[model samples]
Target: MGTWLRRVLLGGLLITQGAVQAAEVTFDDIQPILQARCVMCHAGEAAPLGLRLTRLDELLKGSKGRPVVNAGDPAGSELVRRLKGISQPRMPMTGPPFLSDAEIALFEDWIAGGLKAGRNPPDTPVAPAPLQRPAAGQPVTYAHVAPIFASRCVKCHSAYGLMGSAPEGLLLNSYAAILDRHERVRVVPGAAGASELVRRIRGQSQPQMPYDGPPFLSDEEIQLIVDWIDQGARDTNGQPAPSPVGARVRLQGVLGEGWTLDSLPLVVGPGTRIDKAPEVGDYVEVRGRWGQDGRVLVERIRRR
Candidate 1:
């Protein structure tokens, strides 16, 4: 081979190796970057766009009840927007939020690679099970609740992980630990009104949990969690608890599958939707009432 051709071929080989590195955006690469530059404010009570760059699950969950990284759509992902300095006040606010060329390339590669979530590779495998709900009125178990905490809270509170270092020694690493410290300064069960966790998410208290504002928790999610805790906070097989008042809604007629009354007052039927008590002909339901114009209310739907 000619000398010049040999040089060109070697350069092409190096370029290929670089491409492989770019394709490997793992937790190790993304986590520390977020924890150091983003998590302090974004983890809880201080996020800008409700985007929590905290945990892998939270990252996948994304903003506005949607995934920020839509797999191969890097241009559509908010991560790209913030990183590209496209939005006002470029991220890392103070110091240069500069990502190395390699880092940026890695992110692009990750996006192209399905934006795959969880720990990387087969060695540190992540469970592929989809999100599941525990049976209502059951005692809270480690398996079920861990995923919740891991998804929602542990992002900032756990050490040896991304998000912030343990804030004031509040360790959410285990169920025993969380319960042991439940009533101290934060976890106030049976009283969502007084619980710091509830208060923080509701934005009624300062220094909000999740560190991100407004978009942190949906009104429905916050209420469900609070109600769960208020119901003596039971797990997989406890006695039934009283259903929440004013927040209940009944379903009627043959509805689509995968729909539930977890969040009441959800719009149903065609054209119009209402959460509160609806009048007759309005096609609404409040605690077992199915009528429009708020006149008569019907009981919960019975299956054939």
Candidate 2:
């Protein structure tokens, strides 16, 4: 064989050998990068989606709500999508200076290599809890709503969010932040109709929420939020939020759904002071505010 041909053949052999000898990726390979960039938002009890990336076990466990990384399927992992900005809010929350294309590819390789950074893969990994929809008629609370916001809304509305700008000054990372009384009134304890949050999500108001549309929140997901707001937007403890200023609804229906006058459903609790007992067909006027369960807690009822 010619000298030049022999050299070319030798170079090709070396390249093929290098590909065959590539080392398997391990947890140690990705730890430093995650520790520096992701650990802040993904560790401890308050981690969004309870995705603590501090250890191999935790990373394997993935987000409590969904798989952040899918073993051998980089295309399926949310972590890869976020790092590449294929998903919104993106990762490291604060970036520009975001993970480079090379960094993202390294992550893809990690996932494609069965997701064990350094430790031996578990015999049977623990599957993280799925984001289950609440059962029918279950009273909605922060537990049900927080995940929705963390996954969908906070991307633009949080301080550490992508680009770090709350488009319309709405920040929903926490219950306090969501409830912080602002001029826009994102949530109104017992009034879903009056809430800007609901309006935007329902597409009733301009610039429909989550800001990222087309694949908007599912009907079930949107209802969870509506139910939470209509149910007095309570915390995890489920205590009654202070009622919204009651409207003078002089409803006169046959007590089917609502109104002492127009038939609006009113919650006549043990503490309600009834005046002049009214028959089933009688008209009445009710004065009350929002109750813990979202119904109008009647303070005073008079048969009209």
Candidate 3:
């Protein structure tokens, strides 16, 4: 039905079915698909950020009164970013179960081509960008923690966020801002247990964060922040910036390759607490922190 062939499917722009490539895509091609896949939480008035997917116009109207689409630029579009998860909180809200490559392509091509009702050949080129992942056992740093803030916190902690810009003059929108030595400092690096940020999210303090949900930062997400702080609140370069010690992490995995846990070397010290005498080939749990030398300095270990 389209003038183009579908071969390379990626992130919803179904230009790839086998190898996935773009087709003569149009809004009509995917309207029904969105109706089926996205109209759930995104259809009615109570939708988050006022974003609705019942029609092309509504989708184009965007969320928070900002445009989610970017005419022919899928990378610049927030909708595509969320679909591919380049942005925070991947969508459909009920997914993994997410849109198929073909389904996603229809939307991708529609956006990258014309993002309109009528069929049209692609006028703009679309290709997947390379993705980056951290190296194994990488110590948590501002780089890891920053995106989480941007995704979950900044909406309320910004000038555009609270009543008059960054409540109590505390901002979580950037690296330096979060580390601001202001009177209302939120992060106290290396010591998440003592940090105001951690206390609030863990609900040990008043008014849990995201200030918006029962759907708070996931355990994995909170752990990431905790790890960042515990590892001494390192910067993007894995270097600490004069902070306190973070709470210990609970790591469970099989012991392998001589004093290695999950392929990482463990530093046993006079201070390390051990129980049941763990050995190689035994399953165990370790509670520890990243040492300055880039290895786990075991605080406690036990056979599980």
The best candidate by lDDT is 2
33-65 per-residue lDDT for model 2 (tens digits)? 775566645656756667877667787788878
Instruction: Please give the RMSD to the true structure for each candidate, in Å.
Output: 18.2, 14.9, 15.3
lDDT of all predictions: 0.50, 0.67, 0.66
Q: Give lDDT tens digits, candidate 3, residues 14-110.
A: 4245343345677768766665546544645555688877666677789986899898898888988888778766654434445677777767788
Whose TM-score is higher: candidate 1's or candidate 3's? 3
Write down the TM-score of every candidate: 0.34, 0.43, 0.44
Model 3 TM-score (2 dp): 0.44
- Against the true structure, candidate 1 has what lDDT? 0.50
lDDT of 1 by residue, 1-304 (tens): 9999999999999999999866566566565566544554455443445666656666776775566677888877767666776753344432232556666666666787676654554233223233344666555433443444555565556653344467766666554445443224344344444344565676644455666344486665566667656655544344433323322222332222333222222333443333454333333222232224322133433332
Best by TM-score: 3
The runs of at least 3 residues in candidate 3 whose Cα sits more than 4 Å from the true structure, single-residue gaps closed, are 1-59, 63-113, 116-135, 162-164, 244-304
